[model samples]
Target: MGKILRAIKKIIPEPIFDFFSPVYHWILSLLAAVIYWFPSRRGRMKVIGVTGTSGKTTTVEFLYRIFTDAGFKTASLSGLWFRISDKSEPNLLKMTMPGRFRVHRFLYEAKKAGAEYVFIEVTSEGIKQYRHKFIKFYAAILTNLSEEHLEAHGGFENYRRAKGETRI
Candidate 1:
C-alpha cells in the first residue's frame, strides 16, 4: 500500500491531486451509499452510456446539446467536460477514468441538479476495473471499434470484449 501510494504520488500531478482532496472524500461517501443501497438498481436519473474507441465524447456532446435544445435539464460526463443541466465546466483532472467512485458522485450531482438525463462515456479501463458495475444504463451507443489499448488489454479479442460486451 505504501509503495502504491508513493507511485501514485509520483505519477499524478500535484495540482490535480490537490483539487481532488475535498471532493474525494465526499465522492467516497457517495460511492459507499450507492454500493450499499443501489448496487444493481439505477438511480432516479436516466442514464445514457456511450462507449467506443472514438466518438464517445462527440456523441455525448451531441446528446447534451440536443437535450439542452429540447429544454430538458441534463447532465453529461465526457472526455471534454462535465456538464450539469445546460451549464458545463471543464474537467481539468486530465484523467480518462477518475477513480472508482467518481461516476457515482457525478450521477448524484446530476440528481441534485434536477437532471432528467445523464450522459457518460464508459471507457474500457473503467469496465475492467468494475467501475461500471453498479450503475444501470438506459441506453448505450457504440460508435466504432479499433486496435487501441492493446498493451493494457493484451489482445484484440479481450479489448473488444471489454468495450463491446458491456452493451450486453
Candidate 2:
C-alpha cells in the first residue's frame, strides 16, 4: 500500500496533487479511524490535544511527566518521541503530527495498553491535512500562536485557523 501511494505521488503533477490533497487526507483519516475502531471515540482514555507553533513538544513532555509522577498511566506523542507509560521510542518519522493511520493506530494502541490519558502534540499541518478530524479530544491546550509556516499555510491567519481546528 505504501509503495503504491509513493508511486502515485511520484507520477502526479504538483498542481493536481495539491488540488486533491484535502480530499485524500479526509478519506484516509476516516478510513483510519474506522480501521482502528474509532479508539478516541470509545472513551477509553482522555485525549488531550496540544497545539501551537512552538512549545507543543515541551508541553506534552511536561504533561507526560506530571501524569506519570502522579501514578497515572499516560501516553504521549510528540515530535521527539512516542511514549506509553514507561516504554518509549524515538519518533524517527520526524513528523510532529504523523499521518492519519499512525495517529489512529497510536490511540488504539495506547487505549489497549491501559493508558488513562493520551497527550498528542498537534501541528497546523496535521490539522490542515485532516489528521485531527476523527479524534475526540477530551481537552485542548493552545500554548501560543505566531507567524510560522506562512508560505505553506498561505498566511498567518490560515495558520491560526488550522491551529484552532486541533480539537474536535
Candidate 3:
C-alpha cells in the first residue's frame, strides 16, 4: 500500500493529490480498522488517548509507567518511543501519531500481546486526518491546549475542535 501511494503521488499532480488527500486518508483509516478487526472495541483493551498542543508524549509515558508498575500488561505509542510491556524502542517514524494502518496494527499487536491497557499520544493533525477513527478509547486526556497549529488547522477554534475530536 505504501508503494502504491508513492506511485500515485508520483503520477498525480500536487493540486490533484491535495484535493483527494482527505478522502484517501479516510478510506485508509476505515480500511485499517476493518483489517485489524477493530482491536480496541468490544472491551478488548483499555485504550487511553492523550491529546493536546503540548505534553502528550509525557502524559502517555507517565501512563505507561503507571500501568506497568501496577502489574498490568501495557503498551504505549508516543512521540518518544513505542512500548509493549517490558520492551520498548525509539519512535523513528518522527510521527507522534502514526498513519492509520500503523495505528491499527499497533493496537492489534497490543491486544495480541495480552496488554490490558494501551496509551496513545494523539495529535490534532492526526484527528483531522481521521487517524483516530475506530479506536474505542476508554479514556481521553487533554494535557493542555494553546494557540498552536493555527495555520494547519485554519484557526485556533479549529485546532481546539480537533483536540476535542480525539475523544472517540
Candidate 4:
C-alpha cells in the first residue's frame, strides 16, 4: 500500500499536484485521521496549539519543559524535533509542519507512550495545507502575528486567516 502510494505521488506532475493540492490534502488528512483512529480525541490527551510568524518552535519547547516540570507526561512537535515522554529526536524532514499522516502518527505514538498532553507548533502554511486537521486542541496560543510567508499564503490576510484557523 505504501509503495503504491509513493509511486502515485511520484507520477503526479508538480504543477497539477499543486493545483489540486488543497482537495488532495483535505482528503488525505481525513483518511489519515480515520486510519489513526481520530488522533485529536482518541488519545485522551490535552493538545495545545501554538502559532505565530515567529517563535512557535521555541514556545513549544518551553511548553514541553513546563509540562514535564509540572509532573505531567508530555509530548511536543515542532519544526526542530518531536519529544514523546523522555525520548527525543530531530525532525530531519526540514518541514516545519509535516503532513497530516505524520502528525497523526506522532499523536498516536504520544498516546501509546501515555502522554498526558501534547504541545504542537502550528504554522500558517501547515494550516493552509490542512496539516493541522483532526487535532482537537485544548488551547491555542498565538504568540504574535506578522507579515511572513506572504507570497506563499497569497497575502498577509490569508496567512493570518490560515493561522487563525488553528484556534477552531
Question: Which structure among the candidates has the greatest TM-score?
Answer: 2
Using TM-score as the yardstick, the better of models 1 and 3 is 3
Model number with the top lDDT: 2
- Residue 35 lDDT (model 4): 93
Q: What local distance difference test score does each model get?
A: 0.76, 0.92, 0.91, 0.88
Pairs of residues at least 3 apart in sequence or in different chains that clash in candidate 2: none
TM-scores vs. true structure, each candidate: 0.76, 0.90, 0.88, 0.87
Better of 3 and 4 by TM-score: 3
Query: Number of clashes in every candidate structure?
Result: 0, 0, 0, 0
Candidate 4: which stretches are off by over 4 Å? 1-19
Clashing pairs in 1: none
- Model 1 lDDT on a 0 to 1 scale: 0.76
- The C-alpha stretches of model 2 lying farther than 4 A from their native spots are 1-17
Distance from true position, residue 137, model 1, in Å? 0.5
Candidate ranking (TM-score, best to worst): 2, 3, 4, 1
Instruction: Give the per-residue lDDT of model 4 (tens digit) for 39-109.
Output: 76874799999999999999999989998999999999999988999999999988888778899999989
Q: Summarize candidate 2's per-residue lDDT along 32-124 as a digit string, tens digits.
A: 999999998996699999999899999999999999999999999999999999999999997998888999999999999999999999898
Query: Model 4 reaches what TM-score against the true structure?
Result: 0.87
Q: By summed lDDT, which 10 consecutive residues of candidate 4 come out lowest?
A: 1-10
